[model samples]
Target: MLAFAGAGLWLLLAGPADVLGIDSGNAGMVLLMTATWTALYQVGRLPPEDVVRVGSPAEWKAWIGTAFMAAAIAYFLTRGEVLAGVTVFNDPHAQRIGRNLVLLLVAWSVLSSVMASRWKGVVEQDERDREIAAQASGWGRGALVAVVIGLAVLLGLSPASRLAWASHLMIANLLIFALMWSCFVEYAATAAYYWRERRWQ
Candidate 1:
């Protein structure tokens, strides 16, 4: 987990900077957001017996509360800053980048928390759930593989398609994220079932 955190920090510093063309302040905000977001995710995933039940009304309240919390964090992190020096909405590229980042962070937090809550029910899985999970995993894997191949071809042809390269890359990144997320969901479902099965037996 420390290794994972370290890698995330590295990506936030090196990868997001180059991708977003952001300098120090924006980079720092993004890094802080990423770190906090990850921390919240881990907190949400605490074992059912160890933490608040995620699907309960209280947990729902917490999830909504955290969205506001995240918004506050984003505003404070970006407020009165160099990146905000430019008109936030006027520049299409900057606006899109910022919007994507914000939405991604909030949505990740909400969804992860909900899933952690649902994981309690997931612990009671049966054979039907396992079979459905198997199917989902198979389909998700195929789709993920296809997307990777398609993206690779697009990357190879990017030099030739220079006119829309930026747009292509941006969309490609979104699609890659979606595919990765789907694959992860499938794997998580399967793993959860096996874990529950072990506990049951």
Candidate 2:
């Protein structure tokens, strides 16, 4: 939960406007995207032994298609402009690309889950996956600790700076970047762990 705590501290210090760079409506949508993406990934990652029948290949295909469509909707509404130039078609095309990428990721996750579940025998535990996850967790925690200490030291050194408001906002963004980066590192580490475990066995 340190990641969440750090994010919270960042938000408290920086406020949503400075970090998110949008009005409340858009900011809320960004939050929604983050939640939706994470949820989609989790839902697509059910263990093989769950024995729920999962559905046929056709059903899986439909689910993937639906995920892509949902992503498309989200991309156009939010991140589409991120890729734009001053030109006319730039924004729309960028939105399409962003949507397509989201769809690809969703499709890949579903497809991988389906393939893993198709194995005829018992699924073995992957040791490398465990190690990677452990490392990721360590890094994430370390980031949080370092951030808190740094903020404390900075504040103690110059309490007057906090009144400037920008100081806190800067700290907030740093915390956000740290938390996001740590989370990403952990995810990569976890994926690597699984790959290595599969390889070693």
Superposition error at 178 for model 2 (Å) = 6.4
The sequence of per-residue lDDT tens digits that candidate 2 reaches over residues 1-201 is: 334433433332233444455433234334444554465457557664553244433233334444434333333334323332313333544444434444445545665465455543643334543455477578667766776787677667876745354343344434544554454444544444444545797
Q: Tens digit of lDDT per residue, candidate 1, span 7-48?
A: 544443334435457543345445555665676578666766
Model 2 weakest 10-residue run by lDDT: 79-88
Error of 1 at 134 (Å): 2.0
Poorest stretch of ten by lDDT in candidate 1: 53-62
lDDT of 2 at 127: 58
Give the number of the best model, judged by lDDT: 1
Alpha-carbon TM-score of each model against the true structure: 0.35, 0.34
